[model samples]
Each structure stands twice: as structure tokens, then as C-alpha cells.
Target: MRSSTLRRHLGLKHEFQYRQWCKANDFTSMIPKDVKIRKNAAEAAAASQTIIDDHAVPLPRKERVIPYSDELFQQAAIEWLIETDQPISALEHPRFREMIGIAACATNGVKIPNCKATRQSIIALFKKNLYDLWTQFAVSNFCCYMVLSAY
Candidate 1:
């Protein structure tokens, strides 16, 4: 097969695997349809005993172990600041760094950018959604308080 064809195949395989991983982790998204021929060929190759293990189809070479998505960062920020009810100012706290670490762990040990730029980016993202998230946190807390008081 031409190198271009192989590269395309590798991309497809990675896409399929990534979809599977996300689904297995209960992340909701529409999984793209796998290319039927590629799927079948891969299955057949796995089933067949090739003559040499060394020449076997190589595992996909992922450029990054953890695929960084904007949504992931947003979700993590929501989880940290809203779900856990941390103050917006707490973004400067070490707890925020721990939350970022948790996000990295959730992606199966993907390398998280821990530099100044990454911190700035996350801070910006959190700032962008601050008002809405704060409203949500207040409402949730009030509801919980009302429920407890009634009991």
C-alpha cells in the first residue's frame, strides 16, 4: 500500500479507537462510522496467523497520548468551580492545579500543559464562563439549603 493510503488507514484506526475509548468512558458523542473495508481487513489480519510477528501491523502511533479538546477543559472547569462549588478566585489556588491534574488523569494520563500559557488559557476559559457558572452554583446551593431546612 502507498504511504498515503497507510497514513489514511492509521488515521481511521485512531479515530475508531478514540471513539471507542470515549464511549467506554461514557462520554456522549456520535461515533463516526468505521470504514467497513478497513474494519474487515483489520479483523481478518488479526485472525490470520502471519508468518512473522516482527512484520505485523504496527500499533497506531499517537502524536499525543491525551487528545486535548476545548470541551474537556470547559468540563473540568465546570466540575472544579461549579460542581464542587469553588470560588472563582480559587483559580489561583493549588486546588485548581489539582483539578487540572484530575482532568489529565481522566484522559488516561495524557500530558497536560503545565506552563504559564496553559494556566493563562484555563484561567481565560474559566473567566469566560464565570457569571453563568456562578449563577448555577448559587441556585444549586440555595436549593440544597431549602431542602435541608425543610427536613
Candidate 2:
């Protein structure tokens, strides 16, 4: 049977729904708890990319995170942006860009704002021109208020 025809018949919400049906009928041993959260396929392709294995460490107070001064983080982000430019969205992912900026700023004796830029365009601008980006978004947006705003 064609996939579209099957889709028309079952009217499952998505691919995972069919997987759930399979699991319920004993086609598989277990159903994933968070099937909605798809794994990043690009990360799998980049075998050299370091997977952050540290999930157990508790998030410390704002002052607790060791500031990024070593330049290692910046280098990695630059490598990705410069070399492949594959998924421009990495520059867009708030989590990824913040990590890069936090590490870079901390190394420069500047505090990594508890908040960081959210818009992808602004984030890209930040990479190209820091002062201009700061002027437009207002540096205050990336300051400690971001923690509360983030929530």
C-alpha cells in the first residue's frame, strides 16, 4: 500500500503515530517516552562533534558557571559557521549561540548576560558586528533580566 493511502486511512497525526500503533501491536519492545523530540540528524553525521555527556551537573547560581575565557568555545562555533554553513539555524538556535557568546564574552572580562539575543537575525548580526547589534537590540536585553525573561 502507498504511504499516502495509508496516511489517508489511518489519519495518524504524524509518523510517530504509526510507530505507536506498531508498538502497541507488539512490533517493537518499547515506545519512546518523548517521541516528539526528534534526534538531531546533523549531529549524528558529525561524528567528530563532541556530545555533551554531562547531564547530571546541577545548574548553579548565575555566578556559578565558570566563565569561558579559553577561546575554545568560540573556535568551535566559528568552525561550524565558517566551514559548513550547512544549517544556518545553529546561529539561530538560542541555546547554541548563547553558549558561544557566553564563552567569548566571559574570556574578555565581560560578563555573559544572564539573557542573550533571541532573534536569529540579531544573533547573526552579533557575530558580524557586535556594537551595531548591541545598539539595535539594546545590550540590556542580554543582561541579567534575560534569566527572568527566559522563563
Best-fitting candidate, scored by TM-score = 1
lDDT of each: 0.72, 0.59
What TM-score, computed on C-alpha atoms, does each candidate reach?
0.22, 0.18
Backbone clashes in model 1: 0
Candidate 2 structure quality by residue, lDDT tens digits, 24-99 = 8976412233332334444466786766777557676554454454496567667878797657677778887687
| Top candidate (lDDT) | 1
Q: Name model 1 segments beyond 4 Å from true.
A: 1-66, 98-107, 110-151
Clashes of each: 0, 1
| Candidate 1: 10-residue stretch with minimal lDDT | 28-37
lDDT of 1 at 25: 98
